[model samples]
Target: MSDFAIGLCGIGAMFVLMILRMPVGMAMLAVGYFGTVILNGTRSANALLLTETFSSASNYSLTVIPLFVLMGNIASAAGFSSRLYEAAFAWVGWLRGGLASASIVGCAAFSAVSGSSVATAVTIGRVALPEMKRFGYSDALSTGAVAAGGTLGFLIPPSTGFVIYAILTEESIGQLFMAGILPGLLLTAFFMGAIAFVTLRNPGAGPRGEFVPFEERFKALLRAMPLLLVIVVSIGGIYLGIFTPVEAAGVGAGMVALMAGISGNMNREQAVKAVSDTVRTTAMLYLIIIGASVLNPFLALTELPATLGETMTAAGFGPYGLLFLIVLAYLALGMFMDGLAMLVVTIPIFFPIVTAAGFDPIWFGVIAVIVIEMGMITPPVGLNVFVVKSVAEDVSMGTIFRGVLPFWFAMAACLLVIVVFPQIALLIPQAMFR
Candidate 1:
C-alpha cells in the first residue's frame, strides 16, 4: 500500500484505540511506532521511539509545565484563590448579577496563576458558588459564570494550552502568552455582558449583592495583593523582557510556595501533595508530547499535510477561507474531544496548513486556544461544566449547560472580534518586542 494510505489506516486505528478508552498518548505512540515500522523498518522505528522519548523529556521548555502547575497548586493551598474571589466580590457583588460577575473576575485572576481550566473552575466555584447560592442567585447564572470563567485559564497568561501550543508549533511561548492577554480580557467583558443580558431577561435570576463599605473593600483588595504581585512579576516580567517564560514559571512557583508557607495554609502534607500532582500532570503532558513527536515523522513520510494544503490552495481556499473552515472544524471537535488532546493530535496537521496559507503562527495559537475554550464549555465534553456540576451537586448537567450557553456565545463574539481584527491578539506582542 502507498505511504499515504498507510498513514490513513494508522490514524483510523489510533482513533479506534481512543474509542476503546486507551490513553491518548499510548494510542498515538502505538500507532506511530507501528506505522513507521510498516513504512520503514523495525530498526528505524525503534530508534525513533528512544530518541523521541529522551529528547522530549529533556527539553528545557517542558519545565514550565510543572513549575506553573506547582504555582497553581500552592496558591490554591494558600487560599489565594479565595482571597481573589473576595476581592472581586467586594468590588462587583453589589451590582445586578454581580456575584456571578465577581466569579468570572476571580477566575480570570486565578487563571493568571492556574493554567488548567478545570482547576480554575473548581477553585473559584468552591468559593463563589456557595456564596452566590446563599445570596439567592439562580443556579443557571451562578454555574454558567463559573464554567465560562474557568475557560480563561486556557486563554490567560501561564496557560497550559499556550505552553503546549508553543512547544508544538515552535512559536515563542511569551508571544503566545501576550497574544492571549487582550483576547482574554475581551472575552471576560463579553461574559460579563452575558450575565447582564441574562439578568435583564430575568431579574430574579441574579439579585444584587449586599453593598460593602469602602473600608472592607480596600481590606479585601489588600488581602489579595500578594497574589496580584506574583501574577504581575511573573507574567509582566516576561512581557518586559526581564525574564524568559521558564524563569517566570520558576519565580511564580517559588513565590507562591513562600507565601503559602508564611500564611500557614500549605502545610508539609499539602506541599508534598502539590509536588506529587505537579509531577503527575507534567508526566501526562510529556507523554503526549513524546507521542506527537513519534507520530510526526510517520505523518511526514506520508506527506498528507502538504497534500491537504496544496489541495486547499488549488481549490481557491485562501488564508481566511481556509482558516474559517479550520475554526469550524474545531468547534465541532470541541463537542467530543478533550481540548489539549485535540491540540496535540491536530496542530501537527493544521499548523502546517495555516502557516502555509500565510497566517501568523502566534495569531493562530491564540485563535486555536480560544476555540478550545469554547469546547471546554460546549456540550457533552465540556470539562469545565462537569467540574462545576461536581461542585454544585444539586444542579443538573442540563441546567449547567444552559447556564453556560450565553457565555458560549460571548466566546463566539470574542472569536469574531479577533478574526475581524487580528491585531487584538497581535498588538501587545508587537509593541513589547518591536
Candidate 2:
C-alpha cells in the first residue's frame, strides 16, 4: 500500500483504540510505533521512539506546563478564585443582569489564574451560582453564564491550550499568549452582552443584585489585588521581553504559592493537595505531548499533509475557504471529542495546510482556540456543560445545555470578529514584540 494509505490506516487504528476506551496518548503511541516499524524497519522506529521520549522529557519549553499548572492549583487552593469573584461581583452585580454579568467577569478573572475552563467554571460556578439562585436568577442564565465564561480560561494568558498549540506548531508560546489577551477580553465582553440580552428578554430571569456600597467594593477590590497583580506581572513580563514564557510560569507559580503561604490559606493539607493535583495534570499533559511527538514523525514520513494541501488547493479552496472548512470540522467534532484531543490529533494535519495557505500561525491559533471554546459548551459532549452540571447538581444536563446556547452564538460572534479583523488577535503581539 501507499504511504498515504498506511498513514490513513494508522489514524484509523488510533481512533479504534480510542473508541475502545484507550487513553489518547497510548493509542497514538501504539499506532505510531507500529506504523513506523512497518514503514521503516524496527531499528529506525526504536531509535525514533527513544530520541522522541528523551527530547520531549527534557524539553525546556515544557517546563512552563507544570509551573502554570502549579500556579493554578495553588491559586485555587488559596481561595484566589473566590476573591476574584467577589471583586467582580462588587463592581458589576448591581446591573439588570449584573449578577450574571459578574459571573462572566469573575470567570474571566479566575481564568487569568486558572488556565483550565473546567476549573474556571467549577470554581466560579460554586461561588456565583448559589448567589445568583439566591437572588432569584434563572437557572438558564446563571448556568449559561458560568459555562460560557469558563471558555475564557482557554483564551486568557497562562492558557494550557495555547501552550499545547505552541508545542505542536513550534510557534512562540509567548506570542500565542500575547495573541490571546485581546480576544479573551473581547469574548468576555460578548458573554456579558449575552447575559444582558437574556435578562432583557426575561427580566425576572436575572433579578438585580443588591447594591454593594462603595466602601465594600473598595474592600473587595483590595482583597483581589494580589490575584490581579500576579496576572499582570506575569503576562506583562512576557510582553516586555522581561521573562521567557517558562520563566513567567515559574514566577507566577512562586508568587501565588508565596501569597498563599503568607495568608495562611495554604495549610499543610491544602499545599499537598495543590502539589499533587499539579503533578497529575502535568503528567497527563506530558503524555499527550509525547503521543503527539511519536505520531508526528510517522505522519511526516507519509507526506499526507502535502497531498491534502494540494487536493484542497486544486478543489478551489483558498486560504479563507480552507480555514472555514477546518473550523467547521472542529465545531462538529467538539460536540463529541475533548478539545485537547482535537487540538493534538488535528494540528499535525492542519498546521501545514494553514501555513501553506499563507495565513498567520499566531492568528490561526487564536481562531482555533475560539472554535474549540465553542465546542466546550456545545451539546452532547460539551465538557463545560457537564462540569457545570456536576457542580449545580439540581440543574439538569439539558438545562445547562439550554443555558449555554446563547453563549455559543456569542462565541461564534467573537470568532467572526477576530476573523474579520485578524488584528484583534495580532495587534498586541505585533505592537509589543516588534
Candidate 3:
C-alpha cells in the first residue's frame, strides 16, 4: 500500500479502536506501531517506539505539567478553593442567581492556580455543591455551573493545555499563557452572564443567597487574598519575566503549602496525599505524552498532515473557515475523548497546517485551549461534568448536561469573540511582553 493510503488506514483503524473503548494513548500507540512496521520494518518501528518514548519523557517542557498539577493539588488540599468560594460568595451571592454566579467566579479564580479542569470541577464540586444544595439552588443550575465553569481551568493562565501546546509547537510558554488571559476572562464573564440570564428567566431556579453585610463581605477578602497573590505571581510573575513558568509554579506550590499549613488545612497526612495525587496524575499525563511520541513520527512519515493542508489550501478556504472546522472537530471529539487526549492526538496533525495557514501558533494555542474548555463541558465524555456528577449523587447526568447548555452557549460566544478579535487574544501578550 502507498504511504498515504497506509496513513489513512492507520487513522481509520485508530478511531475504531477508540470507539471500542481502548484508551486514547494506547490506541494511538497501537495503530502507529503496526503502521510503522508496515511502512518501514519491525526493527525501525521498535527503535522508533523506544527512542520516541525516552525522548518524550525527558523533555524539559513536559516537567511543567506535573509541577502545575502538583501546585493545583497542593492548593486544593491546602483549602484555597474553600476560601475562594467564601470570598466570591460574600461579594456576589446577594445578586439574583448569585450563588450560581459565585460558583462560576470561584471556579475561574481556582482555575488560575489549578489548571486541570477535572481538578477544578471536582475540588469546587465538593465545596460548592453542598453550599448550593443548602441554599435550595436547583441541582441543574448548581451542577451545570460547576461543570461549565471548571472549563476555565484550561482557558485561564497556568493551563496544562498551554503547557502541552507550547511544548509541542515550540511557542513561547509565556506568550501562549498571556494570550489566554483576556479570552479566559471573557469566558468567565460569559459563564457568569449565562447564569444570571438563566436564573433571571426562572426566578425559582436559583434561590437567593442570604445577604452578607458589607463589612462581612469586606472581611471575606482576607480569606481569598492568598489566591490572588498566587495568580499574580504565577501568571503575572511569568509574564513580567520575574520567573520562568516553572519557577512561578514552584512559588505557587510553596505558597499553597505554607498557607495550607498555616490554615491547619494540611497535616503531614494531607501533605503526603497531595504528593501521591500529583505523582499519580502526572504519571498518567506523561504516559500519554510518551505514547503520542511513539505515534507522531510514524504518522509524520506518511505526510498526511501536509496532504490535508494542501487539500484545504486547494479548497480556497480563509483562515476563519479553517478555524471553524477545527472548532467543530473539537466539539465532536469532546463527546468522546478527554481534552488532553484530544490535544495530544490532534496537535501533531493540526499545528503545522495551522501555522502554515497564516495563523499565529500562540494565538492558536489560546483558541485550542478554549476548544478544549468547550470539550470539558460537553456531554458523554466531559471530564468536568462527570467530576460534578460523581460528587452530586442526587443530580442525574442528563440533568447536569441539560443545565450546562447555557454555559455551553456562553463558551461558544466567547470563542466567537476571540475569533473576531485576534487582538483580544494577542493584545496582552504583545503589549506586556513586547
Which 10 successive residues of model 2 have the least lDDT summed?
Answer: 304-313
Lowest summed-lDDT stretch of 10 residues in model 3?
60-69
**Candidate ranking (lDDT, best to worst):** 1, 2, 3
Better of 1 and 2 by lDDT: 1
lDDT of 1 by residue, 297-345 (tens): 8988988777777887788878899998899989998997788888988
Q: Over the stretch 122-232, how does candidate 3's per-residue lDDT look in tens digits?
A: 888888889888888888999999999888888787888888787677788888888888888888899889988898799888978999999998889887898788888
Off by over 4 Å in 2: none
| Per-residue lDDT over 260-351 for candidate 2, one digit per residue giving the tens place of the 0 to 100 score | 98899878998999899889888888988898899999988998777877898888877899999999989998988788888998888899
Error of 2 at 303 (Å): 1.8
Off by over 4 Å in 1: none
TM-score: which is higher, 2 or 3? 2
Q: After best superposition, candidate 2 residue 2: deviation in angstroms? A: 1.8
lDDT of each: 0.92, 0.91, 0.85
Candidates 2 and 3, the one with greater lDDT: 2
What value does the lDDT take at residue 385 in candidate 2?
93
Using lDDT as the measure, which candidate wins?
1
